[model samples]
Target: MIDSKQKGMIFNVQKFSVHDGAGIRTLVFLKGCPLRCRWCSNPESQLFKPERAYNPNRCLTAEVCGRCAKACNEGGVTLIDGLICFDRSKCTDCGSCVNACPTGSQTVYGYEMTVGEIIKKVEEDDVFYSRSGGGLTLSGGEALAQPEFSLALLREAKRHRLATAIETCGVYPTEVLAEACKYLDELIFDIKHLDDEKHKKFTGGSNEQILKNIQYVFENFPSLPVTVRTPVIPGFNDTEEEIMAIRRFVPLRDNVQYEVLTYHRLGSPKYGYLGRPYLLGDVKADDDFMRQIRAKLREYQG
Candidate 1:
């Protein structure tokens, strides 16, 4: 077994997270992803390498001096239309500009961390986890994409006697997932679309393995807590027919819960900062539409 003291590259370690799993939890956001979902809310989590992000809203006038531009060696920082223009490709992610920018315009994604370091961070809130039944939640661009590191981290958390959960896209191999599942108390799986072709078109991968994995987990570990989440993306998989198709796959077991997450533009800005296009521009599911979809799913609950 690999030593848990080995460090892993992480994007963020969010603490006191409540919605990710049972109770108040610490969410470890791992880097790297295989699928490129158009509606992904955390685009920064996709790349394994560190990236530069420019927030124009946070830019200060060059009249104060272009210290950020002077600090960059890759010609990534430039002034355009009175706003800072960052060429992500030219960025080295050295964090020099981020430090030199008095206005906080330059920011970098991804950080290096070790399993022992993360466990120490999580242990800080041990009291809260025990009191509220909350523990650690492993989330990512895709946690299984970094299986070895993730598994090791989970093992370390278990050694500390903390409950663990994983939020996965279900795009990985069965063997890898099975190994990780052994250390998890709950699994939150994302099911974007029931149709294979549609799923491929949106998430850049077929539904063949994803659906199979869910079925496999349910059939083999019926007692394990599982939640199936569907992000209701507009013009994609938000139709009543699509929702009902997903409902059909939900196991009749009372331990399983199905949820429909309404789409939001929260991560659109990340695409811009990364110098990538935002496909779902200004497209978000309204509250009324989300409610209707939820109501439609309720009809099939019985």
Candidate 2:
């Protein structure tokens, strides 16, 4: 058996995904990330370790029965003022609470899988990949968070001559980027905000490292295609100035491409699942707004 040290924690392995890369692809969703973006669609992906999510709607209160609290040895489950209170501080995230819950209210986020296991799954879609000009794309929390496992997975894919891609936030160490660039045919890097303060305020990290890595990828990966994506959020980086700031800095001319993704509030309900308040409240970006942003970007598109 392969040692556990080489395994990666995966949240999901989605098949036939079109938006992740070119054509039909199998996208492996790795768990854990370095950034804590307030508007992150997958709130479950931020933590490096396994964490439990509680759904109040599905939870049959301790009043219904004390199954979860009884199953938890760490005293992590509690009834606080007639509501189910999961004390994450005391929790070991052993999945006991999830398993004991009769209503399926609790769910755990991460798991370990070897590189060989992931490659086997990727090969299941080999025919689709061949037919549609697509293969495997490693998506994250930030694939580089699990650098060795991500690289191993990509290396195995390359052995089979499959096309490989990575979607990153571009904040990883330069050495890691250098190694990954060797295997990756394409990279979709996220550029949240050009202004360091605003970027830090929302994503809880500065854009300094991200921008540096982006420039490094653009310059070094001359033969590979790179796309810089920005999640356009209202009241934060929704204006022409914010958009242009990132555009002019990145210098997307040839293989480097610029893309503006419309922000969706679909993950709002996810905050409730994770027992946290949604930061953006009811704020949302409309289609017309996205059209304007796209049009504005087209004005500068090469």
Candidate 3:
């Protein structure tokens, strides 16, 4: 029996997302991930527990609003030269300052929500789902990392007769992947690199388990629609040889599709908000190079 009351740490519940799944969809971003990819955009989603993020640009100077500093019991927030300064080292992530902030600048990234509550919110867009063939898509730091809660959420979503999907890194146990597929209508899996060492070096986890899990999915669930994506990060999997290695690994079945996602620094600023370093720095993806690779792959396939 699936428990609707089971809670999961969710970072964001993005609405009207058109990328993760078919048509317009509601994306539930789950918190926690096993692998820490250097180019990861959602650094806030990396940790399991909720953390506070301070955006100085949105802060109404300390002179106007010192509420955040006043609310900080740990002396983490302070006013410096008309600017609100946050000392992340002292902050406990208790969310006191986030609550005190009048402007939306002080924000907490992750929060706990029950499957029942999440479903209730998702059902609000039932009209859009019916017309656009879109429903719930679970994205994360890694949805499979939160196995029980994620599975329960999927089951609950299915009970509501909604189309369900998940964007997974496929780094979990095959058992978890097996269970998740039963409830998922679409599977968006990331195959970062075929080489285990390179994969580990870049994403901080070996690709052996990931490859095995993905292979298990294909062999067992032949009917499930799978979209395998490779984020084209410069100095990583940008070369045709590297990308092709992964393309060769994935089976070319009718139900399986492959795509390359261009890397971007869109989430670099978030690192500053979270007081974390953006490892990728000034590196940028060559869109033209990626396009050429895609064309070459098609030609090779033909």
lDDT of 2 by residue, 1-302 (tens): 23323689988899999987888999998988889888889888888777688887887787887688788888788777877778878888788889898887888877888988888889998999889999999998988988888888888889879899999987789889889889987888999898899998988898899988887877877878888889898888988888888888877568788888888888778788777888877887877878987888888783
Q: Quick one: ranking by TM-score, best first? A: 3, 1, 2
- Clash count (model 3, backbone only): 0
By the lDDT metric, which is better: model 1 or model 2?
A: 1
Expressed as tens digits, the lDDT of each residue in 143-260 for candidate 3 is: 9899999999999999999999999998888999999999999999999998888888999999999889888989999999999999999998899899888888888888899998
On TM-score, who's better, 1 or 2? 1
**Which residue ranges in model 3 land beyond 4 Å of their true spot?**
none
RMSD for each model, in Å, please?
1.8, 2.8, 1.3
Clashing pairs in 1: 7-114
| lDDT-based ranking | 3, 1, 2
- What are the lDDT figures for the candidates, one per model? 0.86, 0.84, 0.91
- What's the C-alpha lDDT at position 41 in model 3? 89
Error of 1 at 58 (Å): 1.6
Q: Write the per-residue lDDT of candidate 1 for residues 132-171, one digit (tens) a residue.
A: 9999999998888888889999988899999999999998
- What is the lDDT for 281 in model 3? 81
